[model samples]
Target: MPKDSRQGSTLWSTVLADLRTRLDAGEFTERFPSDRELVAHYGVSRHTVREAVRRLDMIERRPRVGGLVRTPPTVLRRLLDTLTALGVQTSRTTTTGEHHSVEIAGRLDRAPRTLLTVHTAVLRADGGPLICLQICSAASDSVPSELADMLLDGSDRESGQVSVVYEGTVPAAPDPEVCEALGIPTGSVTFCIEARLDLADGAPILQRAYVRPDRYPCILQFSAP
Candidate 1:
């Protein structure tokens, strides 16, 4: 005779263990399997499946780097989550669109003539400038106006999947606008993170970010499976 089934929690734990093992083997690359699929495969209840997924999320916690908050580098994060984690208030400083530069266009896999929206905002700690963020996204006729509005509001909703992220320091030259917004001297260095999010077609959807290093130093940390 076959062995009896385990309890709900016990079965969930067993399934979670199996999933983790598979994850370590790089099974779920693009996206995780659906909860219903997991439930069917593991012979567990829907509640059990959800609890297992929740545990995976809590296995890792975000870290604070200076004034910036970043989640484990292994997972992708939305801009709002990162800002909210700082536990500080913020306000939008500027939101404008301009013709894409050759370099930026190349990075975004878009045409130089394409109009790209530049969204800039300042994060405040105790009513002072902590960091300034500038995000650039595609503003083509193909993209819906409502979705474009979200990007202008500094959101990456329905943007795409993050394919690559690069971090470096840019030696700033005399820029009146940056100097004014960040309250820093000309030629001051700025920390920048450029992420390339790609659609299923493998075309870039968005790229580029800028932050004040002095006020919002950031670090990337993660663990091996």
Candidate 2:
């Protein structure tokens, strides 16, 4: 092969590899770049850009319907269930500690002056950090044995509890502590889930979790009426 042609081939292969990495990292979730945009961004010829994207099965190109569209990443129907469906093995580390936060106490329906036991857990999948959870409940002695056990192991054992979950996204930059725990760099985005579990005959348990969507995308399914 000619020297310039060989260099072009190598460059396109490099672009293809980077594109795959960005796709897996959820960078193109909202939009897939145009051939012109990719050419400009990667400083390659339009033919080179097309050659790189042509091999990506996740991108669909249809005539007149739309330009290149990215297929959504596979979603985990529920994270609380065993991660076997996603072929991921998960492990967790829990630390028992005390927290005195008015906000947490209010959520748990405890007195502002009461001391709370916080169970901080960092869940990993296949040795990679997945999520970090902080569960707050009444102090050690007052907490039910079952609830405490569940908290310690990071299990979802709300047999007779009313659970309300609030989810949103937050930038990881401001939360250096959480970024370190989740093994994600600062300036990355994370999904945050806050759950209030109200037991039948006990104070509510407040759980806050930060999840890395790029690593583990999750979706909730609802049936039509």
Best by lDDT: 2
The RMSD of every model to the true structure, in order and in angstroms, is: 9.7, 14.9
Off by over 4 Å in 2: 1-77, 144-175, 186-188, 217-225
What is the alpha-carbon lDDT for the whole of candidate 2? 0.65
Clashes of each: 0, 0
Clashing pairs in 2: none
Q: Return the top candidate by TM-score.
A: 2
Judge candidate 1 against the unseen true structure and give its global Cα lDDT, from 0 to 1: 0.53
lDDT of 2 by residue, 1-225 (tens): 112255778877888999898876768655677877776788778788778888887687654332554332212214645476567787777677786888778776678877898777788888998877776787843544344346424343334333333333333432687788898787677776666665555457776777787775556454443
Q: Give the runs in model 1 whose Cα sits over 4 Å from its true position.
A: 1-26, 29-86, 141-176, 198-203, 216-225
How far residue 83's Cα lies from its native spot in candidate 1, in Å, is 6.6
The weakest ten consecutive residues by lDDT in model 2 span: 69-78
Q: Kindly report which residue pairs in candidate 1 clash with one another.
A: none
What is the Å distance of residue 128 in model 2 from its true position? Answer: 0.6
TM-score of each: 0.49, 0.51
User: Scored by CA lDDT, what does every candidate get?
Assistant: 0.53, 0.65
